[model samples]
Target: MATLSASPNPNPNPNPNFRSPTDQTDHDPESLPQMELHPSSDQDPTPNSNRNFHAVLPTPPEATAPAAAAAPSLLHISFNQDHGCFAAGIDHGFRIYNCDPFREIFRRDFDRGGGIGVVEMLFRCNILALVGGGPDPQYPPNKVMIWDDHQSRCIGELSFRSEVRSVRLRRDRIVVVLEQKIFVYNFADLKLLHQIETIANPKGLCAVSQGAGSLVLVCPGLQKGQVRVEHYASKRTKFIMAHDSRIVCFALSQDGQLLATASSKGTLVRIFNTVDGSLLQEVRRGADRAEIYSLAFSSNAQWLAVSSDKGTVHVFSLKINGGSPGIDRSQSASDPVTSPHSSLSFIKGVLPKYFSSEWSVAQFRLVEGSQYIVAFGHQKNTVVILGIDGSFYRCQFDPVNGGEMTQLEYHNFLKPEAAF
Candidate 1:
């Protein structure tokens, strides 16, 4: 009953235009790391060309026979307690399959004029929301349909003037961002709750649930390089300008303590403190120009993964400690910048390790158990499953790690190599 939505690839390039003081700190160009060549980017004279470069695409597992010929395009993806499922919204309707088994379980052909686009699942209630529309000018206005998986029927329909960019469900309420406005709706009766005028064009929406209380809304504004975290109950707003270019995609940590934002012009993934909007860590990987399309945090918040347009997902481990000593204290007391350490002395550290295979990923999610990360490719229509360790599991998921995978296999896979 879990629903997943396949939206357009927010990151069309792996190198995003990220703006940071550190980016402009002025490191000599000659001191930068050397570029490595990979099969995917052998011709490109840039770093990150060697990251996750595959010589040949692997063969599909025999279990995926039914969908072998169907052009693989991700429509929606979700994880249940045991298994992960991906649905492809095609011309007929939608199809669901198990991530590990790669076997088809359900297929519905609604015959409701093809061109199905956005898909989402209401986690708490197990409802599926589907949007039917495309970019074609001839396409009719977008429409939203809620499907009751228990009965496998369309339970409700909401029509919109423009395409529905993103949707999130919080308890009895549904929040949707379309074009320039955000709408809050009561799920039970489908009544309009509140409509807020958003400054940037709303491209994505994520909600964190608080039992019986209001949820926190995370809105990623297109081309604005801004993310707004609003406490619906308190009506308080925290505006985070993390990236310099348009923020293509972002993901919130499971515990709601950290937020990861990736831009479309640079390769840096910026992590921020959810409570105070402070910069925690700056994770850098890939070519400086790789466009990051999506990002997600593991269930344990120990790991973060970023997917890009160049077809690679980079993973980083999050390290938390009492803040580092003051910059002046670390140096000499006589340093001109030396100052007394304030009460706020601690900082969080995020370190980037390496990236996985190269693929054009649109969106990704972590499974419930945190064993694997699913990344959906906009170009291949295939889901690339990368084990936290390094083993490659080719299935239909996004290219990002869903959450942290703590299994022994993953731990062993990610074990540090001995230094020379």
Candidate 2:
């Protein structure tokens, strides 16, 4: 609600270059806010910085507010299961925001070490799992500090022999991903429930369905580009050869009924039926190579949102039928890819690989490589995006037109003058 800087914006992209939209027309890029953040000394070990703006949050002795061009880059960003709120890992510490109005609800500066490299919020918001990273190194890489916001303290933690890459939280399970293994624990007691051997997952890639109906966990398999899906209730595991190249990203629907995976190629995203591992639908982000950042399935399971290094977010409408079986692998292979131009895709099989991928149903393109994360909103046709530069955007899409999404509101999380 306040401007962090008194001076003019130090950096602004005069013109942002973007590729052709996958479905709709390209529109204006949302403007970003500039802010500075510096953590001060804290006497209380675990200060609730949200309400107590003056609360002490001890930082390294030689730290100052980030300059306009030197704002901390986001290490990780995650949306809660309900999509009502989002959390981000920043240099100073971590902050949680209410998605609807796009305002900061909680701002906790890393008291001792440095910025939290990885941060994930559980269910409603009482608990948080955080790890060390960013320009400042706070906690050990091998442990996840479970912070209890209510008590304003780290009440518990999960320790591992190796660095923790990422964490996924649910009502009953805390899934922790390491370089080559996944640990699933009982949330209540933190007891080791099951351990999974995985390939070299440097990114700590893992996802768990948050539905109360059934529990499903996913992580990298032993083989490259393979995904291991574990049905906790049934106690069954299935491996799907998800990609030709190494898997880049994967997301499961709330109910675990669908799975979407992308490869290093980044051009195509494949959706599968979790039950039978059948290919459901395939969508295209573009015809070029890019790093996939995050993928999310809407709460209702009707839309899929994808963010990547290209500084663009694409939302694709899914066609899931309850009665009909998923697309047959053989028939799906021959299905004509939806090309941008009919002439270019007339012979999809013979056309270049670029043309043989299904384009996104709707797209929102920004300056290339903003490093963003996307989530479907609770209200229909809405999406939320948080950028690496600390920019937040809430937009609405028109499913019928298959066009660009419109920005509803935006905020700069770093804009508070009190951040210093």
Candidate 3:
């Protein structure tokens, strides 16, 4: 396999003492904490006096050429075991490539259909779910199709109540969250297993397998600032609340332990404990408002990659301390001694920043057992491989240092010869 690797930085802490003393307090800042201030008398006198701030600005030629040369424009990108593929969904259907060689395996066309909107892989069965629907009249609903990769045949059609926004494949079930409700169907027979109603239109849906017979739904509702989690089998609501100015996106760890949420308002990303619905860490980046559209965790549950509206992918490492920080429920009780209440404490860790870049991340996945390869889908259908610095990765599960993703492998899966 063709691999792109970077030496892991031994010390991930670019700013160890970066936290302000005020951050330890419970209150969030109303405005940006003053970094530096100048009196009116010191204000710039001329129109060009603020040139200090523009000193490093890139020239137009440099700006235009850099972005154009970074990577090829893509239609869609996905990651498999050792390969990553990019498809030009509109013109030619799909292409398959080896991640390491970056070599074209095949090029297939599904030109009869207009294009593909979403492409997802069934982790358990190794099937591909291609959803096609857009503003174009030629490509309306009923275009959703599932293909068997090994056999290379379109074996099934997925029916949805409304346009399909997201599709998640669990061990034995496929959950499709549409405009109104979430439908869970058996992957084997495509039989409806359960349906979940939503308070607001769902913008995103993520299913985390709980290993036994349970699955957790982390959904971002269309209404401003709404997010919820529901236990599918028990039909029990787990957690629901407004976390951001506009809840644009949310994601759950594969193990169903951690939940990462982001908003369209700015650079704030919050992590919560899935077991008790308690806030664990809050991360803020950049000074201006930014919209986060996608979030993903590596399969091993150690790193989180967040993509914003500005086309930037910010990656962070998950760190867990040995002991859980105790929560004081006494503040909420009318009678602390007599109230039927109990407090819970669990492990706590700092969610320090690991890596950041201007490349927009649409989707990301980690290769199982391969700590080096972390694949991500980018804007304009491109994919970029990143090298995770060693210092920034720490496993939250049993061993705490196994989450370092240091390499990337890209494959082109869509081929013209394959059935579209």
**Reference-based TM-score of each model:** 0.57, 0.77, 0.55
How do the candidates rank by lDDT, highest first?
2, 1, 3
* C-alpha lDDT values of all predictions: 0.46, 0.68, 0.43
Maximum-TM-score candidate:
2
Better of 1 and 3 by TM-score: 1
lDDT of 1 by residue, 1-420 (tens): 112121221222111211111233333333221111111221212221222111211222233344334443333343321124444454434544444434454444442234456555443233566665443211223556655444344445555666677666544566777777777765655556666655565454454532333466677643378887776667777889988788766776544556788777756778887567888776664545865545665454444556555545445545533221111112223311211122233321232232321222222333323334444322222444544233334423222432222221111121123111
**Better candidate by TM-score, 2 or 3:** 2
lDDT of 2 by residue, 1-420 (tens): 000101122232111111111212321212111111111122112222222121224332224343223445577787876778888887657777778866666666654436678888764445677787766656666777766554445545555678889988875677888898887766655556788999999988888887656788888899988999998789889899999899989998887878999999987888988777888888888778988988998776667899998888988767666612332212144322232333466678886766655667678877786688788887778888888777888888876666788988877776645242
lDDT assessment of candidate 3? 0.43
Which candidate should be chosen as best, given lDDT against the real structure?
2
RMSD of each: 20.0, 13.3, 23.0
Please give the lDDT score for candidate 1. 0.46
Off-target runs (Cα >4 Å) in candidate 3 are: 1-75, 78-91, 96-107, 111-114, 124-126, 134-139, 199-207, 210-213, 221-223, 233-235, 322-420
